[model samples]
Target: MDEKKPSRMYFIGKKEDLIQAKRTTVTLDGRDILLLYHQRTFYAMDLQCYHAGSTLETGDMEEINSKLCIVCPKHKYKITLAEGEGLYKATNPTEKVPTPRWYSKGIKQRVHKVTEVDEDIFVSVSTCPVWIESDYYQSEKGRAELKKAQESGDAEADVNADEDV
Candidate 1:
């Protein structure tokens, strides 16, 4: 098996600080990233929604399909904490099932690994090419880069074509 090298980790802040703040938006390399502390675990992801440019720091966390998800306050889109997978409950129009089935939109959010050492917290951006990129990345050049990535088969296809704190 091939082993991958670890991504560079950026120092966030003290775990105590996150525990007190619950959620925080940090600037990394001039880009805003959101850090969330919930259920005794830490999560780091893009600061804004992948669908629209709304903030995710105010988003509510809920369990969907047995996965911890952050529901966007502006549009109610559910994004998972484990790997930033986007999920939507789908219902059968013909059948009479009351509960809707969940489907994956295939990682629509860019998530990072959070590590805690004693009292300090650090975050490492995912090495994979994620589908969930927004903010300044939505510019013309950014879109062109995205297009190139898609053409190179690095970008995942979308269900509805669509992140997180």
Candidate 2:
């Protein structure tokens, strides 16, 4: 079994200082998260908007129709800071990687939570759990057979032939 490395936590501003600070940006693992202190509680979220990767920290935080909307500086994309969902349901192609159409449909953005421990704040930076494929796919013979089927353009026939002979 492989051992997982624990995430390192850094101490930002104190609880008292956070209340006085309107909006403070903290860098964690090369990613920036804006910290907003409201009602004696601290809320932290991604500084960049998912729509066009616009910096959301500099945007105005106002209530529109009883909903908190963070207006994007680039395209004026109104995104809800509470729910982390963009107002307009538009699929903008990411500059980093092209996502499959099926996978991107009805996808909601995720906002990570920050926990206040003692006097310091901690954010979980662990990677997703690894999923293992089937035992056949893990074997060397299965890889060779898959390669042969791909090269010959007889994947279905090879799979069926292997079961019989």
Candidate 3:
């Protein structure tokens, strides 16, 4: 039998802080990240919006479609909380047709795994979504990189893919 090593966890704050702020910012691994509490659940995500790099900590939070969404201050892009995907398609109401679709879909924010231990909040910074872990390695570039890494047995290439919820 083999035991897996645990991911590095950085202490964010006490559970009380999460309860008080509902949303707060914390610095872990020298990166500023946001900790959000919604519906009695805790979530940690990147501070910057993936769409236009707007500071997500200062963006507006809304509950839509039974999910938590954040409106990017820069372009009003609605990003979901859990998966960090866009809650709505990026469509400009002013134009009959929105700008030519780019990048396939709305930008996805990078999120970290959150855990509660002893009434404290800890997050693993190195882990992120699949796309982000590959550094947004999409299309042909992404496929080639993933294949090469896998053939070479580069474990880090699939780091995020192994994280547990």
Report the number of the highest-lDDT candidate. Answer: 1
Error of 2 at 89 (Å): 8.7
* CA RMSD, predictions in order: 7.8, 16.2, 11.5
In candidate 3, what are the lDDT values of residues 10-99, reduced to their tens digit? Answer: 887899877888888876755567888877888878776554344666678887666677776656767777777665534566887777
lDDT of 1 at 49: 68
TM-score for each model: 0.74, 0.51, 0.62
RMSD of 2: 16.2
lDDT of each: 0.73, 0.52, 0.64
The alpha-carbon deviation from the true structure for residue 145 of candidate 1, after best TM-score superposition, in angstroms, is 16
Candidate 1 positional error at 101, Å: 1.8
User: Candidate 3, which segments miss by more than 4 Å at Cα?
Assistant: 1-6, 89-107, 126-165
Residue 92 error for model 1, in Å?
A: 2.2
Q: After superposition, how far is residue 147 of candidate 3 from its true place, in Å?
A: 36
lDDT accuracy of residue 20 in candidate 3: 87
Candidate 2 backbone collisions, by pair: none
Question: For model 1, what is the alpha-carbon lDDT of residue 7?
Answer: 78
